[model samples]
Target: MARTVVPYSSLVANGSLAQPAGTTIDQSNGMYIAAARPELTILRVANTNGTDRVVTIKAGDNPPALAGGQGDLAVTVAATSGVQFIGPFESGRFIQADGTIEIDFAASFAGTITAFRVPRGT
Candidate 1:
């Protein structure tokens, strides 16, 4: 899977992402954020698969390696559905210092996740 620093406006703007389209993630490939870590307020996860999928999030810049059950919080998205984790969250809740904020999957599936932050640009 490919992951990069996408614009925080990607959620509000009605347009395509400057980054590449999202791919499948599972035991083999998982989403990783390492380039730039800024405090994010919104997290949108869209699952395009035929079956339901679970999205796992670990917040930190130097978090432990993925070994299943590494999620600080996990949310399940129904098949072909989407959900947004909105936040003007408590301090340290939505912030990622470096690349420590990791978003992963429990099973291989097709989906896209975009994060939005205030005064964007990292």
Candidate 2:
């Protein structure tokens, strides 16, 4: 199955940022984002379930075959309206060969997920 692509909401400097109605998490196929400038990308995960859920940012396979490889980052979002902001990913460690970052969910998740890209300055 194809992964869900999360569109990025660009942030403006010295301006008001609109709140987004994020996309629903694709627990089955997972998700991905075009990470051209990974260092400026951020992910927002909101959990609306009664139980805590784990969100995993799968590590990239770029520059493979090293002594010690990077592992996936797993973050726990607290239950009931809990929100977690993750990233500003390192390109070499999180950007895939196809120029995107992959995300996975430990289990069925409730709520929405949003991606944000910060401007170069501020």
Best by lDDT: 2
> Would you estimate the TM-scores of all the predictions?
0.55, 0.91
Superposed by TM-score, candidate 2 places the C-alpha of residue 40 at a distance from the truth, in angstroms, of 0.2
Error of 2 at 75 (Å): 0.3
- The top-ranked prediction according to TM-score is 2
> Each model's C-alpha lDDT?
0.52, 0.84
Where model 2 places Cα greater than 4 Å from the true spot, the runs are 64-68
TM-score of 2: 0.91
Encode model 1's per-residue lDDT on 2-33: one tens digit a residue.
54333344443444446435433443456554
**Residues 4-113 of candidate 2: C-alpha lDDT, one tens digit per residue:** 99999988888878899999999999999974567898889999889999999888774531211577889999998999999887786777777888899867688899
